[model samples]
Target chain A: MKYAFYPGCSLEVNAAAYDLSVKAVAKTLGLELVEVDDWNCCGATEYFSQDELTACAVIARNLALVDPACGQITAPCAACFLNLKKVDRLMSEHPDLDQKINQALAAGGLKYRPGSVQVRHLLEVIYKDVGEEGVKARVKRPLTGLRVAAYYGCQVVRPFKDFDDPEQPTTMDEILKWLGAEVVDYPVKTHCCSGHMTQISEPEAFEMIRRLLYCAQQREADVIACACPMCQLNMDAYQGRVNGFFNTNFNLPILYFTQLLGVAFGLQPRELGFGKELVAAEPVIAAKVGAA
Target chain B: MSVTVKSKRFVDEVIEETPGGHRLRDCIQCGTCGGSCPSGAEMDYTPRKMIALVNAGRREEALSANTMWSCVSCYSCTSRCPHNIPVTDIMYTLKRMAIREGRVKDNDGPALARAFTHYVDKYGRSFEMGLATRYHLLNRPFAAMKMGGMGMAMFLRGRMAFTPSKIRNIGQLQAIINKARELGGAS
Candidate 1:
């Protein structure tokens, strides 16, 4: 299966691991990802707070850039996925806004026909296009003993009903199970990671992060497999601070699902962007997925 | 005792500012948003109470409240609101309003938010290192100093970039942004 891939800004820099693993896993699964040419940022969560039109217009520009023949564009970053999906949904729902946004796009010699492209999260494509059995059939080194908590974060399933159950998503869980990993029942699976809050207010943000980590720890998850880059960043990077603040000893490895899939596919950890994480995945890798 | 009259004008202005907030009037005073908020304890006004402040035309109190900055935009309240009130969107509107009116409290939320916005405006995408450095140096240098070790780790791991990846046709992006600002403000 092939789709237009919108990697967004995070993939190019901080979340490079997610980008690498996504490409590696997609190649392993025979999914073709045609990168959208010259795509810009998706305005993330911060820009929309400042100005609605500018934010939507920026995302609309990327939508217009996608190859229309592909019909579907898969965004791996949850924030990008939501921003792209949101602009498409809003434009279709409100024609006036669509008209205004299109006028802005027109300046760049682009025009996004809302509803022409189906914006989907990468996990959705993996679940729907490449079914669980399909992924399982390709697993070379099964992650049989590893326990995973599928962290959906907030955007992927909430505000609008997308691919999975918003309140209780299982696409990640099911996929992990397919790869021979143990999927734990995490009640706060849909909870917030406070996204950029870790940068803004550490005390408040750490509290929320503490709960997610504490819950995953309680469930005895070997690693928290996440789809969003921001979630992975906050959960992994601030783990030290959260531990420092709460006076708890927690060392949870936050990894992208694709990275885990890459391991299951017997791919190299470095190729999957393994060691780039703040919280070390080496112990888990050595214990479960094998030596780096 | 003074009577609390609902300020229709303030509520209408907020509703007009953000189309996503059209359902503000539909709020049934349900505390679901407040109850579900993870940072409710830190908020000066709960989402439920904030909406009431808006309804009652307590514009100054509502706009200046620290509650809006505490919002993480997790969509928990928006997703679970009984009346389907776009509570988070309303929060967004409130934040924008707060920022515009210069009512932002002395907090890291607004400081960091502006830092993020500044990078997006300049690079057409966020520059992580630049944002971190700029925010720390300008807003909280001591905290930045404290986190120097963590920064070094990120740098060594190549997680932080020294430069931003620029988008082609940046001029076009700027034009689009300028047009949006003009059109957006005209409304």
Candidate 2:
């Protein structure tokens, strides 16, 4: 199945692995992902709090260009999926607001109608369409003994309440099970990564970050699997700061869901967006395609 | 340098009182939840201690303690809990109840909570620096030392974007917030 794609801001800078691993696996699975041409930011979580209309305008401009008949717009990053879903949802519920947003977009020669696109997180498309039955067929080498903590972060499920149950989500679990990996059940999986707040509120963000790592350590999770760019970026990048702040030692590896999927897909580890991560998964992630 | 755990009256009430009172029931007592808490060391009552007090029913002392005010609501305890207890949410509910019951007496918290309520009421969202600075100023009158330093730094760094992100229609916002207040029975 082919889908138009949107990779939000983090993919470009902070979360290169998410962008890479997504493109790599989408190609391998024959799931054609045509990135919306010259796409801009989806406004992610930042803009909704800034100005709802302006945020809608920003996301609508991207949606306005998408070929709706294709039916699905898959985002590898959970934040992107959430942002796009927000615009799509708000546009449907509030026509006047949608009209205003479309008008703003028209200045840039873009036209958008509400509900023109279905925003699916990359994991959802991989799980629902690609299914365990489908994934099992492609699993040349199963990750037989790996233990994964599926971290959904906040935006994927909260507030909008789309895709999965907000309080307890299992999109990642269903996907992980297909890959022949043992998944750990941890309640903190959906907690906020503190995202951009790390820049604004270090102490608070540090506490949140530390708490997450501490929990992962306690659960004996081999690696933290994430579906959002911000979660991947912060969980991987901010570990150093967190360790520094509290004067502790930790080597928790953060993996983008697709990176782990790439491993599960029998793709070479190097092609799976491993090196781009801040908290290197190298030591823990035995990256050989046939070696679990 | 240290404090003992408080009575379990407020604690037990807190455990039994929440919408999902059973959340407090599944505490494996693994201490991971407490170990995972960032502010656990700072608080007189770690979440584990609070849960124990609640289960034991000396919750009034737990409720009245100053520790309830220190939770940052980062969702650390709840998320990390092996039991899936909504510890942070329990903290939120407790804070609400505590305020109603006059448990906490502080300038920083009530003022901060007031700003948080204003954000929810006005825009259906939260603004970090704006609320922080506002709370700080209100708490200190003219001497909000903590807030002033942080606010001035954030403003100069162009980090605190203060143009309120107004809801599309203030009227609609008022209606929704009013409805929420009605449902929640908030005056």
Candidate 3:
């Protein structure tokens, strides 16, 4: 299966591991991902709050570039997925927005008719297209004895409920289970990671991150598997900071679901961008997948 | 402050300007939004109280409240609101209104908002390196120096680019922004 992939800005920066592991997993699964040429940012969450029209226009510009044959697009980041899916939804729902956004697109010598393409989150593609059996067939190294907490964050399922139950998504859980890792009860799985909240108020953002990590730790999760770049960055990079703020010593490693899946597929850790995270996954993987 | 005729205009304009503005009228002053909010404790006024303030023509109080910036856009309040009032969207509108009206009490939120928008406005995509530098430089100079350790770590990992990766034919992007700006709220 081929998809036009829009690996938004975070993939190039903080979430490089997610990008690397996504590509690695795609290769192992035999799924073809074609990069969306000349893609711009999805305008993230800030832009939407700043100017709805300009944000829609920014996303519309990228939607207009999808190859018709590969019109089914996948975004790895939750924020990007939401922005793209939202703009598509709103453009169709509001004729005024549709006309105005298209007007902006026309300035770029492009036009995107609303609903011309289907937007899916990367996890949705991996779960739907690859299937459990497809993943089960390729586990060279089963992740037995490894317990994981699946972190869905907010944007993937909230406000829109088709991919999974918004309140309690289980796609990532099922994927981890298929990869032979024990999935733990993650009650706070759908909670926000305070996206960019770290910048606005460090203490508030730290508290939000602490809740997710503390829950995962309480449930004895070896690592937290996530689908969004922003979620992973916050959990992984700020894990130490959260521990520092709260006077707790939690050493949980936060890995992209694809990174763990890559390990199970027997891909090398360095090749999957494993060593770059602040809270290293080396020790956790060594005890789990490496040993198995 | 007393609810004067001019303050009533505040309610009228919000109702007129926002897409979900009419939904605001449907709110029953329910505290569900405040209850569900992750950052509600930090807000000067809770989401529930903000709605009531808006309806009561307390424009300054609603806009000046830390509630607007404290909202992390988690969608928890919006998704769980019994009235289906787009509380989060309303928050967004309030934030923009705050910035537009220059009533923002806290600089961090509005500063970050402008930094992100300005970065995107220039590069067509966010430049993390540029955005962080610019935001801290302009807002918190001392904090910029402290971010050195994290910056060095990010640099070593090749996570950030010193230079921005610009989209080809960025002139088109500029034109699109200009057109969107010209069209104002409708665009």
Candidate 4:
């Protein structure tokens, strides 16, 4: 269960909790992660709006950096996954794009050929490689009937088609179900979290958050599970703003996919870096295990 | 409270013109798109009815419907479309057509479009606060004035960056912009 991992910018800067839980839980599940050596930014999808070739090249340069022997690269950030997957698909199709990108890489004295590695979302590693039977076997704490709302956000399933069912993704649902949690049916699960829209339209972005939080609250989802770092920040850190905007009062904690996985596998909140989160996830965990 | 999404000729030309055209005929009539749409309830035509109307060749009515501008292009509908139609693409095309033909008389979507163009034109990329400020000024003037303190507070608190990342490749982007303008029939 060894993998080449790319934690990306968000993991390092904002979503350290997600990064912590991913590392801790990967070990808990016997996953051996080899973080990519000297990786650059994914440039996110918005970089394409400014310059398409440069965006592709920025991510492709990372693709060029992966160890040729490495079969797969796992990204914890959704935007990073999309960026990596886009360049991977592009490189797979047009060798010329690969050439130009590698030519850019040659500027740094590092060159990578495209299709050198497969880009995977962290959730895939949990469900496919980790296996439900293995997760069920490790569940010292079953999240029985917690009714967690699994939000996929847009980037994970778009353009490159990751392991998640692109249109109607079920990876999170399947994993949560295996962990003995009641996976609630949510329509906006695969919808955009308006990634980086927090930068542009605060009101509109707040409304987007409001809609998701409202729906999740209405369904009484014990917590929302996310794989994207920006989504985690918005849904967790901004839930209070949305509640204030709409005059509703609820904390509505957001959990990274790995954090919940860690908890279900008997990892403690403090070890997984749970309490440090902007939105408290301990109550949800406590309620799940009846420890509260 | 009415939107002037008029001009049947404009609608037909747009639907028959782009790669996104004829997607009208592919509508499965599921309202999942509209139901999930954040601004669905505020529109003259939900994404569902907008597709139906276009498919029915009720071009003038569809064009004039108020649903053209509220989409945030989140790819929710396109991502979920069982019919495989890109609802956002269609909406994008419609918005372009509406502006070019002066079909949409409302300032909402057109204002957002103008704000986006202003962003790309100046910085070669979008700055959220810049767009938010411009969008506020254009569409919600009063909100812009009242929300200045709020925006500035966020700015000081490091929640927003005033400087947008600009590229030296603006000329190159203009070429792609030319290509899209042609594809979108904007020119």
Candidate 5:
């Protein structure tokens, strides 16, 4: 299967591991990812609050840039995926806003029909497009003894229930199981990871982070696998602060779902962006998967 | 004496501005949004209560509250609302209204939002290191000092980029944005 990849800004920097693993896993699964040329940032969650129309216009610019040959574009970042899907849906549903957005786009010598390009998240592509049998066929190193908590965060499923159940998602769980890993049924799997709240309000953000970690620890998952860069960043980066604040000694390695998938497919850890995480996944993976 | 004749109701304005916000009027006061919210307690007014305030035409009270700023944009409330009121979109609309009206005070949410978009506007892509440094130094210097260790660790791991990445057609992107600002009447 082939897709137009929209790696978003996070993939270029903090979430480089996700980007690397996504490519490695896609190659292993025989999936082709052609990047849209000169794609800009999706404006994330910040732009909407500043100016609604401007936000939609900025996001639509990326959608307008998707090559006409590829009818589908995939974004690995949850925020980017949602923004792309959201803008498209809004334009199709409301024609006035669509015209306004198009007017804005016309400034840059671009015009987009709302439903021209289908927006998809990478997880959806892997799970539905590749299917279980396809994944099982390529698994050279099944994660036999490893326990993974599939953290869905919030954006992928919520506000738009296209792929999975909004409240109780199991796509990631099934993917991990197919890779021969134990999937923990953690309660806070679909809960918010505070997103940019960590920057705005630490007390509120840290509490949210602590709850996810505490639940994962309580469930005794070996590692938490995330589909969103923001989720992984907040959970992994602020874990030390969460421990310091709550007086709890909790250490959990947060990883992108693709990284683990790459490991199961016999890809090297370094190549999958394994060590980019603050909380090391190498020791844990080595302990369970035998020197991954 | 001159009287200010309001063109539209506060709730109506919000509904009109927010995408899929027409459902705001359909809210059943079921508090599902508040119940589903992860940071509902931190919010000055629960999302359900905010809707109630909007319905009651309590524009000043609703806009000045930290409820919208406290929102993490999780969309849990929007998804869980019994009437599907687009609660999160309403929150975004409220945030825009609050910022435009100069109602946001003693909150870092707006500051962070500004800092984040600042880079996106300038470079067409976000600069994590630049965003963190500028935001923290200007607003929370002490916190910046505290986060020095984490920042250093990120740099060592090659996860933080010192330089910003600019899109090839930055002028084209800016033209679209400027026209958007002009057409959208957003200052």
Candidate 6:
């Protein structure tokens, strides 16, 4: 399988673990990810609030840059995946917006046709493209004892139920099961992680984070597998603060799904960027999966 | 006559501007949007009430409320809406209108949005450290101090970068942004 990868801005820094693990797992799984050249930020949710047209144009620039050889583009970050897919859908639905965005792109000597490139999330590629049999074939170290709460977050599934059920997604859960991990069927699996809310409003953001942590803990999951950078960052980084605010002693490791996949594929933890998480996924992985 | 005209204008404007705003007319006053919203408790007006305000031409009250600012863009409401109304997109529309009309008082949402976009407009990629520093220092200095320990941990773990990464074709990216800004709304 091949894709035009858009790592987005978070992968460059805060979510570097996700980026590393994605590359490692993809390589091991015989997936080729050719990065789009000079790809800019997808502007996340902020740009849309400021100026909708500008936000679409900014994201469309990336779509315009997608190499013609690769008709499909895949993004690991939920926000990036949503923005790219949403803008493409918008352009396809609204011709006037398409013309306006194309005009903006024309300023930079570029143009993109709506629906030209198929937008996909990394999870979808692994789930649908790789298939269960393919994943089962590559699992050198089965996570028999590991209990993973697969956090879907919002963007990837909601508002665009292209691949998975928006309300009750099972892609990640199925993938984890393929790797021999116990998938926690929690109700809040598809809940919001309060993206960018932590920066704007702490109380609100922490409460949102606390809910997810509390649920995962209640379900007795060893670690929370995240498919989005913001989800992992908020859950892992501010977990201490959430505990402080709520007076709850909750310690859960939040990790990217790719990292766990890499571990199951017999890749080293260091190679998959393990110790980078604030909650420390290493101890849990070692204890449960035996030296991942 | 004037009251009727004003009521029609606000709803029409929202429907025209928002991506899925045309469905605003399809709202059935069901509180499912508010019920499904994760941040509903913090919001001044529930999304259901906001849509009501829009329909009733209570534009000022809807735009001035912290409802839109508190939205996490979760889209739970949008997906769950029985009427298929794009509740999240409507929130974005309200936010844009509020910011444009200078009605977003005492809200960090707009400020954060500005700080985030400032870097995207400059370097084509977000500078997380710079964005956090600028937003927190300007809006919530005490909060910034409180987050110092977390920041230190991130830096130590190589998760936070001091310098922003500039794309190779920044000039081209800027040109597109400027043109888009000039062209204005998608309509």
Itemize residue pairs with steric clashes in candidate 3.
none
lDDT of 6 by residue, B1-187 (tens): 3554434589988998987788878889889999999999988899999999999888889899999999999999999999889999999989999998889879989999999999999999999999878999998999999999999999989999999999999999999998998899432
Tell me the deviation in Å of residue B173 in model 5.
Answer: 0.2
Q: What is the descending DockQ order?
A: 5, 6, 1, 3, 4, 2
What are the per-residue Cα lDDT tens digits for candidate 1 across A110-170?
Answer: 8989999999999999998899788988888888889999999899997777588888989
Candidate with best TM-score: 5
Query: Where does candidate 2 stray beyond 4 Å?
Result: A287-292, B1-187
Rank list by lDDT: 6, 5, 1, 3, 4, 2
Q: How much is A56 displaced in model 6, in angstroms?
A: 0.3
TM-score-based ranking, best first?
5, 6, 1, 3, 4, 2
For residue A280, what is the lDDT in candidate 5?
90
lDDT of 5 by residue, A1-292 (tens): 7788999999998999999999999998999999989999999999998998999999999999988889999999999999999999999999999999999999999999999999999899999999999999999999999999999999999888999989899999999999999998798999999999888888999999999999999999999999999999999988888888889988899999999999999999989998899999899899999875
Indicate the worst ten consecutive residues by lDDT in candidate 3 chain B: B3-12
Q: Candidate 6 chain A, which ten residues in sequence have the lowest lDDT sum?
A: A283-292
Residue-level lDDT of model 4, residues B55-114, one tens digit each, is 666767776777755665556677667777767657756665566566775545566546
What overall lDDT, based on C-alpha atoms, would model 4 receive against the true structure? Answer: 0.70
DockQ-based CAPRI category assigned to the predicted complex of candidate 2: incorrect
Each candidate's chain A: what TM-score? 0.98, 0.94, 0.98, 0.94, 0.99, 0.99
lDDT of model 3, residue B149? 69
Q: Would you list the C-alpha lDDT of every candidate in the order shown?
A: 0.87, 0.66, 0.86, 0.70, 0.92, 0.93
As a whole number from 0 to 100, the lDDT of residue A153 in candidate 2 is: 78
CAPRI quality level assigned to candidate 1 from its DockQ score = medium
DockQ of 5: 0.88
Number of colliding residue pairs in model 1: 0
